[model samples]
Target: MTNDELQQLAAGLANCGKALLRMADVLMEKKEDAPAAAEQKEPEKKLTLEDVRRVAADKARQGHMEEVRQLIQKFGADKLSGVDAARYPAMMKELEAMGNDE
Candidate 1:
């Protein structure tokens, strides 16, 4: 191969390497920005009224009525279904913790 052709190929490779380095920098910036954006975002919950009731019914059917009643009383609700939406996640977590204990 001619020297001029080799020099052109070398230049092209250097340009490609610089382009890759710039792309890497852009990705690193996005990674740093992600946590800040995520912190500003409220965690999304997937629970529904039906889901709460269903999880409670499962508890009852499994002979966990005492635990269920305790949760209901703790939350000042008549039944699992009566628990407020905001408290449902906590309620479920308590129930889960109970299940985990045994």
Candidate 2:
């Protein structure tokens, strides 16, 4: 190939590499910022029935099942799995309060 043709190809490749680098920087920036944005935008998630049971079992393991049972009774739940999803947060909060009391 002519010298001029080779130079033109090299220049094109350099520009492409620069573009790829810019794109990489943009992507890396998003990845870096995503966690902070998520930390800010993600509200505390509502707990599920499984979450309630896990916490209850944790309490049970800690010899606090009586307190957990009391909370279940207050919620009209026969067992941790019986508690409504909507009330899981309240149950977890009460459990946390119970934990703090100990």
- Write down the TM-score for model 2: 0.56
Per-residue alpha-carbon lDDT of candidate 2 for residues 11-96, written as tens digits (9 for 90 to 100): 99999999999999999999999998878866777777777788788888888888888889899878777777888888888887
**Candidate 2, superposed: residue stretches over 4 Å from native:** 1-40
Over 14-78, each residue of candidate 1 has an lDDT whose tens digit, in order, gives 99999999999999999999999988968766788887777777887888889889888899888
Scored by CA lDDT, what does every candidate get? 0.84, 0.84
Alpha-carbon runs more than 4 Å astray in model 1: 73-86
* TM per candidate: 0.67, 0.56
Worst 10 residues of 1 by lDDT: 93-102
RMSD, one per candidate, in order:
2.8, 4.3
